[model samples]
Target: MNLQTKIPLKPNTYNQIDYHSKVLLLGSCFSENIGEKFEYFKFQKLQNPFGILFHPLAIESLITNAINEKEYTKDDIFFHNEQWHCYDSHSKFSNASEIELLQNLNNQIRSTHQFLKEASNVIITLGTAWAYRFIETDEFVANCHKIPQKRFSKELLSVEQITESLEAIMSLVKSINPKVAFIFTVSPVRHIKDGFVDNTQSKSHLIAAIHQVIEPRNHNYYFPSYEIMMDELRDYRFYKEDMLHPNAIAVNYIWERFVQVWISEETKTTMKSVDEIQKGLSHRPFNSQSDAHQTFVKQLEEKKHLLQSNLPHIIF
Candidate 1:
């Protein structure tokens, strides 16, 4: 069955599927927002194997810790700040103990390999083209400064490199789950230091790279998260206090936009109507009644409010 509503691409309808399916989100912090909304929608199989930030290194560490049966604690961590940890593109572990936490990392990848073997849909949120590599093994280390930048190298990636990385990752995903479909999105949260002009360039490169890889493939695809953030929530007011990420309202708008693409029209209409009714009830003006008449009057008011308004207007 077509999971999405078949509406015209121009002015797509805001409808998503009623029934939830298992989903795994791996990528940047934006994926966290997507995951939270899925929870709101009560998606049946939402999973975040890589946790927040969706950094490959964090996922590797998480898997390692799970395999070794050792806990991943701060003692082993070089960075404890939630901001850096959420999407650990530029963080690291303090010592060998942190590395020890990753004993199960490989095992978990093997398990992910197994699970994706049968997954129907998988979403990957690509955050950046910059990754840190260890000096010795040429492996991408989770963090650089936790050890030394000198011990590792900063490899700024091109769009081609990102496309290759996603392709490699997707290839692994497909090997484990042959029938799985893939969705790729570039994160909207800005890395301010990348320089305003440079940051914009990087995003363009990333998006272009992702499209080049996925556009020709029948099974792979892309989502316009970058466009929505840049075009829909262009104003600074839509951003959080930190001036980087989108606030709740902006995130909601993005979720709604996504629903237009992934959800069914019928379900969208029903949900919209329900939301309207609820809003109307909440907006009913203050009322008064005698103590003796309180319960009866309140009940009548609620019923009247329900019957009188088919659509509720938001006070704002």
Candidate 2:
């Protein structure tokens, strides 16, 4: 669990599995990306009714709120096209009745908790400790601007508070489903707005809290997503346009590193073949909009020829 040692660390990332795995992803938006990658890798994804966020409190709030009601919909919980549910194309918040919306939210939470109970391995990608909280209730919210920033103020969680919250979450998870194993990871994406020193301190505190909580326990463990990105892939070139989330190439690198830890050698070979094909095609030059389709065709033709020799069979 400790980044230094304890959880038999992988050199790059965890290994890819030959057969699809039934995984439930919790934690931040990074978990959503991981889930997307797992699907891309052909792993069977278990649906989570709750949306992913940087904090568990947000997830818990959604679920708790939903459970108290009866109706449900994906829009009641998930983020779509970078916009939160109510904030998306439809401002359902303004149109939907409170009783109906309340019920939908409750059902979403109940479904999510049920999903967590059945998940074989729960991957939790914690984003940051800094969050905006509602001033009246002292409850932390996901996006403060949804209700106006004046309603909520920013709060920085102490190391002890984070530890306590995580411990409580662990208890909840175990209480509902004793068989599931938890895999913790600190998201490497920087929170440039959290103040450089404070953000750094927050991450350091999280890493320490994770190790302290899980090291003594045999079943719970952590994966070094933060270390892999921060230490191994230090170059800023790996980042995307936002410079917050890792670029596609960087994500591939991180996923590869994760595969090294969990996937078998045979599975690794298959993944490598697939990845090579993708990398080879993604680099083709397209000078203008007109060239895009033609370039794609050329890439496909090149791929076809490349595959003709020493062909790699995808059994699954």
Candidate 3:
């Protein structure tokens, strides 16, 4: 008997990610999780230049800004709680000095602009449909930056709104990079703080909107990350202690499924070699001067050099 119900995933015939593919991952904390895997494999990838953007609107804004080469100025940033923050970005971009914050934001936009133009695959993971709009400026924020609760009004983005945002993102990205393949996935992290019922509603809107835009024939695809979490790994054992996020085991399982679908078969051997090197690098020697330990270190170095020689972009 089958212990778990598997989600059927078809291998992508076109736009399969290989060692040479330059990938750009945006949106959600889950994107970071998958991005971390890409990093470990030493794939050419750039993830969340503006940090983890959760909603479709925020992601749309990021794409629009990057494609247009938006420059951040003093007016774009505001001083709050003794720190300078941009409403369009995550708190990670905030800085103690306003000039530094603007410089960082503009630099990121320029970098992302270049990356998008050359990216082979663009993976977007939408986290929620819920968003907060700052009442003073009537603008949706990627993050609140811990300002007073009364300063903003929370709103749930309708499916129609999300659909439009997704379309806009597609149009903008395609305009700049016609050859880039798009992969959209809804993040599996539950927003329990939004209330359990509200969380369900938020996810439902995101799913509906994503399906409205994803066209496999056009190289725009959707991966069933949320479904896999809810079905295949349907147990609290797969969750962290908070019972909201997937733990390492669940993440690894999902990542394996992702690899089967998106990663190229030609890169499998190289991936295994990279994995071995990663593990060997993390290994601790029982005896620093032992012959066995020295031999192991030497072998690890050889593997590293071999990989780096082929994929010079890959750095340990």
Candidate 4:
């Protein structure tokens, strides 16, 4: 008897990702997990250049700003907890020097602009519909930068608002790169801090908004990452000790499913070669000067050279 319920999944008949595909992944920490898989398989990809943006409006702002090449100034950032922080970006961009912070932000803008123009597949993972509005500025902030609660008001985006935000993202991206494909997925990491019921509502809104824009005939698609986590891997065992994010095993399961549906068959063979090279490169020998170890290192270098010869964009 079948013990598990699986979502019906099939390989994409067109626009499948290969080694040559320049994939740009945005939004949420879960997007990093999938990005790691792409890095492991030596695929051409850029992940979260503005850091992990959790909501569609933040992503929409990023797309619009990047396309317009918005330069960050001192006014765009604030000093918080003795560090400079930008409300439009994750705290990872925070720095002790305000000048450095603004420079980094503007640099990312130019780089994101370039990568986005060349990207073939843009995979966006939405984490939550809940957002924080900085009351003083009357604008939604992507991150609160650990500021006190009273400084910002919390709000949940309606499905219609999210749909409009997503549409704006698509439209802006298409204006620059008409052939780019979009794969939208709701992140499986439950936002428990928002309360259990609120988390469900937030995810529901994100998924509903995604469906409103995804059309296979237009090269816009949705991947059921959240559903697979909720149903197929429906157990506390699949989550980390925090009991929220998917554990590595669960991420691997979801990744394998993604590969089956989106990765090209020819790319799978290249991935195997890349995986073997990766494993070999990471191998540590007990004896550093041994002839056997030296031979192994040489052989590994040769393997890297061969792979790089074909895929010059890849580097170990």
lDDT of each: 0.59, 0.63, 0.94, 0.93
Candidate 4, residues 1-316: lDDT per residue as tens digits?
A: 9988999999999889999999999999999999999988878888998899999999998899999999899889888789999989989999999999999999999999999899999999999999999899899988898899899999999999999999999999999999999999999998989999999999999988999998988999999999999999999999999999999999999999999999988899899999999899888899989999999999989988998999998888
- For model 2, residues 115-135, the per-residue Cα lDDT tens digits are 666666667777888877778
Candidate 3 to truth, TM? 0.98
Q: How accurate is candidate 1 locally (lDDT)?
A: 0.59
TM-score of 4: 0.98
TM-score against native, each model: 0.65, 0.69, 0.98, 0.98
Could you give the candidate ranking by lDDT, starting with the highest?
3, 4, 2, 1
- Across residues 56-105, which tens digit of lDDT does each residue of candidate 3 receive? 89998989999999988988988889999998999999899988998899
For model 3, what is the C-alpha lDDT against the true structure? 0.94
lDDT pick, better of 1 and 2: 2
| Stretch of 10 with least lDDT, candidate 3 | 279-288
Residue 98 accuracy (lDDT) in model 2: 45
Model 3 Cα shift for residue 59 (angstroms): 0.8
Q: Which candidate do you rate higher for lDDT, 1 or 4?
A: 4
lDDT of 1 by residue, 1-316 (tens): 8533332333322222343335667767898888886655445344555444433344434333333344333433343432223122333312244344344333444455555544666777767666677777677754454455687776666777666666666665555566667777888988776677767777777788777777424467777887787776778988999999999988998887777677676656545544554554455445545564576557656654653364233111
Q: Model 2 TM-score?
A: 0.69
**lDDT, residue 169, candidate 3:** 90
Regions of candidate 2 where Cα sits further than 4 Å from its true position: 1-8, 11-20, 59-107, 266-316
